[model samples]
Target: MDDQNKNLILATVLSFLVVMVWFWLFPPEEPELTDLPPVAEAADVTTPSVAAETTSTPTTTPAASETVAEAARIAIETPEFKGSLSLQGARIDDLSLTQYREELADGSPIVHLLKPVGEAEAYFATFGWASAEGIAADQVPGPDTIWSVESGDALTPETPVTLVWDNGAGHIFRTEISVDEDFMFDYVQSVENTGTSNITLRPYGLLRRHGTPADLKNFFILHEGLVRMTDGELEETDYKKIVDYDLDPREGTQAVRLEATENGWIGYTDHYWMTTLIPEQGTAFRSTSKYFDSRDLYQAEAVMALQTVAPGETTEVTTRLYAGAKEWDAIRNYENEEGVTGFLDSIDWGWFFFLTKPIFWLLHNLNVIIGNMGWSIIALTFILKALVLPLAYKSYVSMAKMKELQPEMEALKEKSGEDKQALQQGMMKLYKDNKVNPAAGCMPILLQIPIFFSLYKVIFVTIELRHAPWIGWIKDLSAPDPSSIINLFGLLPWSAPEPGSFIALIAIGIMPIVLGVSMWLQQKLNPAPTDPTQKMIFAYMPWVFMFMLGGFASGLVLYWITNNVITFIQQYTIMRSHGSKPDLFGNITSSFKKAPPAKDAPAKPKNK
Candidate 1:
């Protein structure tokens, strides 16, 4: 009996323990989560290939000048001011690719990479306030800024992009640009190995800004900073803004010096979803040097080779750039482009290109019909709840039957006395005969968990929810609840904590209360256990849960509350159909209409 009791207690405890851990893992992952995401350290041992990469410096040119000159006559032509432009065989004059200013929030600048024939005296350089951030490209008129590649072999501007190799055939690279129905342009660039020898090319998509080497190398600049390191898998960091993150001296097997005389910073940003930039701080500017560790994502070694490529062979690589803000309509349209959507890595959108993405598409479609994130969330939740209603119904039936049999169960327990096995066996027989399944309630709740997590993921990481507004004090459902008491003098305002978002602060506070109340109500529907100690320990579950989720997102808490309320309604409906009072813990006597036991049957025993 003691062993049986111990086993039952252990099972119950283990169930709760496993769920608690699972719940812990469900919340959004960001720098501020209660627990930091685990970081894996690089192994102490080094590989020969990694050693070779560390020692080998791939051929590099002095980075292109950020300054473009107005020396060309067409430089005076006014650039049409609007959203974005599409070009095909259009002659670009005094072309430049750079940020409008040193700030990340500055509007993305317009870039022109092609030019008309005879436009450059070699090249024209300059800058302008492309986005009104008090920054512009400029011309470096001195000899120091220009580089004339002396091709031992003759080459022309119409050279259909060729690869020149020593022992192997070289590689041919091509750059192409396309626009969608919404006029969002995607620049797809590919470098293919056309060489006879196989080669491993260290591919880096580079953008150069015109500024003094001092400014370029020392001052922290650009956007898309921070590399999100995943478990065991490698993803490159967003951007690196070190004063001298670039290699020097052309090519060799040595680490190149990339620092400027003055303090400056550089950046490496890919599209909008991921970026790594270093901020300027103190004498040391913001630097994300760790993001460029090539070994982290691909091969653990760094070698840019156009290795032995068999004749007529090609290795192509392409990347997409999302050059705008989090405008949902624009973004969704942009995502439709082939091979362009993968850049939206901010959301762990499923890789199938179909499964995970449909969630967003469905949400967006519903938005056109409903027009608000709050309403959208509510609608989505209700629909999901409806889909799972059968499970809840099953659980309700189980609960109702269990309530009906409580008295008989208690009577059996007393008759069995200290013989717990006999009591359990008898109870099992009764349950089997009556078609009652104890695990029904548990199974339904467990099934709901994954959906709950998926929704939570959608709410937290989807850029569509960035500043989405809800009703009243719940301005941004994605951030936090803004509903709070306006105590201006308080240390932490219900809405904010000084430097934090007011909406996020309030939302965090409300979650626990909402989740706790629902849990309490659900637990209350079940009778107090016959064991005094068991009842005592379980009584505090509500308050404990309330405290546990105090910092969770208000949206997640809202989902929990809605789920419980729906379950309660379903349970009540099921009970009333059987003519029993669902509010009452058990209707054992009422269900049987107080019938007396037969002579051959054992008499009911008294309670402990």
Candidate 2:
């Protein structure tokens, strides 16, 4: 075989091998309920501060379900959020993201980010003082302690609400909670000591979840669990990892802690939304991830440094809570403008952060300019192809140079047919003499691998693509193309096969069909291989990929189609520029020509 065929075959086989192993190599996410580590008598949420006890535990405060009656609630209304606050612990529970819905269906309920204790998958954030230095446990409010509403009737951007708890021992605790038009909430925690003696206390903010989130996608591509940033470093701890945490000798519990001297936040992040505790930046704080193995609960804590309050003196600390959709622009603004360190990285950029970040940046800006994510993706394909044009030009030029040497290579092959080593030597000398690099043609195909994965990560993980639409039949660019050939794309009276089933694999949609066609058309740029094995492989490759990726997100399939088309155009134009115009029509026509019958073997074959 010529070096061109060898290179092309090697690239194709490598791609095929990668696709074949994709299923088992990168395992799908295990079900949340089934994958628990062995458990001990788990502890409740612990105070991340020193010598301070929780009302529920080795420290004190209830993070699990309780028989306690529902506490009085204050309505929280923001343009992007609508929920309630529980006065019991001044907890921001019962919150829903007004901007997002439970499903794409009409009239679906708004996405609930936090729920009260009684609800399934209960999650919320609470802040309180951890009593220390001679301050009794009762000297500070616990989770069960009810607070008096001291100010606004509702929590809104224009009107902040205040909740007051009196230790009645001459120390008063007040929380003034305010919200922005979007998702951030500010809490001003103030302590005033009226007694003659001073007191030591640490104010802590925590996010607690009861059991695993039932809606966990559990996909390995996305991170949906405990995500935290300490100083400038980021860490993600999944539920299973949290469950397996060893007992901490420092906190004397099943937990992990890291100190952030300057900037940090701790939180639980789901597929699209997040609920995190943001301590004041540029301050020392302890970030902890704790799991109650027995209770099947998880908690993230941001405990501030211990402070002493003198008699008649007041100490106030301001912290923030981010509880809503992880919109890229909004989060980026927090990182760049609001000084949330590495905040934008909160989005799961995967291992390809270098590529995913910039790809998302371009896609985001393109969407902003075009107002349609589908078109933006198509436009992104154009820009990407343009960026790689120089490399692609050299690759195609090398391919054309190889095509120019095909006649010489064939003559050498016939002359050295009985001497395989001589044929190989002749091919190498011919390539070197012509200054043609046989391997150059494979570079673009190899480069496409990483770009493909990075784009897939961005499309699958970013909120910007969620429910984004293009033209008809392309609603929800993040989802598979709903049109199915099995039902004649709804022109038939029956519905299409259910997605992810074997039938759906065979019943691919319009986008995947176009993808296969684009690949086939690109392949037709070169004549069909004369070798039977090579011809069979090239013939089947495109349709095989079509079926394989039929179930992928429409946006990804759209990208693949666009990429293939642009590649075909670039190869054709570059080949023409090199004075080696591809005989595209002749190639397509020749592919349809029936193969000639082989000569009959002699009787010796039958004897064997």
Candidate 3:
């Protein structure tokens, strides 16, 4: 085969392998149709901390669920959040993002980020003092301690709330909480000592989950577990990994702890949402990820160094909690404007951070300008194509030159039959004489692999694309196209088969069909290979991809379709410019014509 065909085969097989592996590793799950409870009945958000203790590892048992049920909750209302803070531990437990819903349905419940105790898979955040050298664990207010509202009745951006508890041991603990209009919660935890002796206490903030999130995607492509930044380094721990850690004898739980000097945050990151405990910047602290196997509880904690409190002295520590949608702009602001170091990395940019970051940045800005994610993706495709146009131009030009020299190369091949070395040397000389680089054509295809993977990461992991609408029938770009061929693109009365099912695997949607057609058209830009193997692979490649990618997010399929169409146009225009006009219609027509039966193999089988 000539270099052009070889390059095509390499690219085709590489892409096929990638998609096949992707299908095996993380097949899309069909979205459930049941409705989640409304905001009033939905009672959870991010994780609430496990009980505090004297040692670094938590030793105190969680208060009964009744404590959360009976504790008076302070109403938490903000522009982006709607929930309540439980007084039991001064935890911001029952919270939901007012801006997003659990599903695309009209009355779907809002996306609750944290849930109070007594709710299934309770998730919430709380900031409190862990006694290190203080009198006793009970001397400080703990999970069971009930705090009365010391100030504001409702927690709002305009009105901050304060909760106080007098330990009756000559010390009083107070937690003052405030929120921004966005998703961050600022807590100032303080303790005042009226006793004569000095006492040591370490202020800690934690996010505790009763179990793995019920809605966990559990996909390898997107992380949905403990994500923490210690010092400048980031670490992500899967639920299973956390469970597998060596047991901490003090707490009888698996725990991973690191001393974070300078800065850090610890939290659980879902696909599109996160709840993190961001200690005040410039502070030295300990970041911990712990899993209690018996309880199936996961806790992410940031505990500050112990400080001594003398008579009449007061100690205060500030920690921030981020619990809500992981909006790129908002998270970026938190890092750039709010001084959270390396906070932007929390978005799970994948190993291709170099490409994913810029791709997402361009896509996000394009979305802002165009006011539609679908068009933004198309615009992004154009922008990326333009960025790589120089390389693509060269590749196309080289392919066109190779095509022009095909007849002579074929004659050379026939003359050099059975002399492989001569054929190789002759082909090299021919390419060199024409100043054509065979390898140049593969560069763009190779470059596209990382870019394609990165864009996939951006669309799958980022909140901006969640439920983002493109056009009719593409309501959620993050989801597979709902208009299946079985339903006649929604024209038929019967419902389409559920995605991820065997039936839906074959009965794909309109977008994927369009995708397959676009690829086929792109292929028609060049004549089908004379070799039967190459011809069959090329012919089947587009349809194979269509089915494999049928269950992918509509946004990704849209990107692929746009990419294929743009590539066809670029190759066609470049070939025309290079004095080689592609007979697109003729090649497409010939593809359907019956091939002259394979010359009967010259009767070699009979002779054998």
* Clash number for each model: 52, 8, 12
RMSD of 3: 6.3
lDDT of each: 0.40, 0.79, 0.79
CA deviation > 4 Å runs, candidate 2: 1-44, 52-57, 62-68, 526-532, 585-608
Task: Please report, as a residue range, the 10-residue window in candidate 2 with the lowest summed lDDT.
Answer: 598-607
Worst 10 residues of 3 by lDDT: 599-608
Candidate number with the higher lDDT (1 or 2): 2
Error of 2 at 378 (Å): 1.0
> lDDT tens string, model 2, 405-501?
5545556656666787777777677776677787776667768888999999999999999999889988898989999999898899999988766
TM-score of each: 0.54, 0.90, 0.89
Q: Which should have the higher TM-score, number 1 or number 3?
A: 3
